[model samples]
Target: MKAYLDIETSSDGRITVVGMYRPSKDLKQLVLPNITSQEILDFLNDAEAIVTYNGDRFDLPVIYKHLGLDLMGCFKSLDLMYDCWEHNLYGGLKKVEKKLGIHRDLPDMNGYDAVKLWSKYETRSDRKALEVLLKYNEEDVLNLCILEELLKAKKVED
Candidate 1:
């Protein structure tokens, strides 16, 4: 019931992926139909909790606007960005990795970089933007497990 979700979207409201993760296996990436509101909602309707990094402000609202529906429903949400910030856990993901002593070195390309990638594609009709976006999106969702573990450990120590 703990669903880790992340999204890759275009500036024009087209969703590229609604990446979903389960603990038993590697995270599964699902491509959403182009700009279809209902399909997106259907994908998200049954989660017991949705966990994301900075999703409360960014990702969820983007999907909400597309769906013409409110996401403030029964499912609980944990925004890792806000949680980390609230607890004075500064530093980007790399910093967190150092502080938490996690050894994995993640890619430097982030959501902002994705915007730039899209811009590049817009000019030259290149597909690298989508490629970068997909890789970045997958990384974001994959890290959710590590983050949740770190947070829970912090809670236990407190």
Candidate 2:
């Protein structure tokens, strides 16, 4: 099984959320206050491969640094960002999504905005901010699957 993953962090680089999406299971998010290494490991227990956009450089490292989960050591990792490069697609995930015409409900939101949303939830106890942050993360996780499919479908001849 393949797992698609994404994470959100605070301004200081502390992990606030870890989102994992598997085609076979309901999306699972490990949010701060309740986020734990065991939960993430368990969620990914059956995964033979983990897919992400820039996971090799970002998501995986953040996970290891924060959770000590070492996902790449446990599972085959396929970073779609490299695949995107082979097809001449460049830029961050959002930029790549826009280039491919992938729809985003929170189209204007970015990682910086994610940090602010987390701050709002933590400092002001705003559930709505947390909700939006979760939704934004949910997109990052779900869209990995879409991006993977589209990348796989691309032809070198094009």
Q: What is the lDDT of residue 36 in candidate 1?
A: 57
- Residues 26-129 of candidate 1: C-alpha lDDT, one tens digit per residue: 56666544545564456555667788877787667876776655554545887887767766788666566567765543356655676666567666867876
What is the lDDT for 134 in model 1? 66
TM-score of each: 0.74, 0.96
Candidate 1 deviant stretches above 4 angstroms:
11-16, 24-35, 91-98, 101-106, 121-125
C-alpha-based local distance difference test score of model 2: 0.93
Weakest lDDT window of 10 consecutive positions for candidate 2:
149-158
Query: Whole-model lDDT, candidate 1?
Result: 0.68
The number of the candidate with the highest TM-score is: 2
Candidates' lDDT values, in order? 0.68, 0.93
Candidate 2 lDDT score at position 129: 99
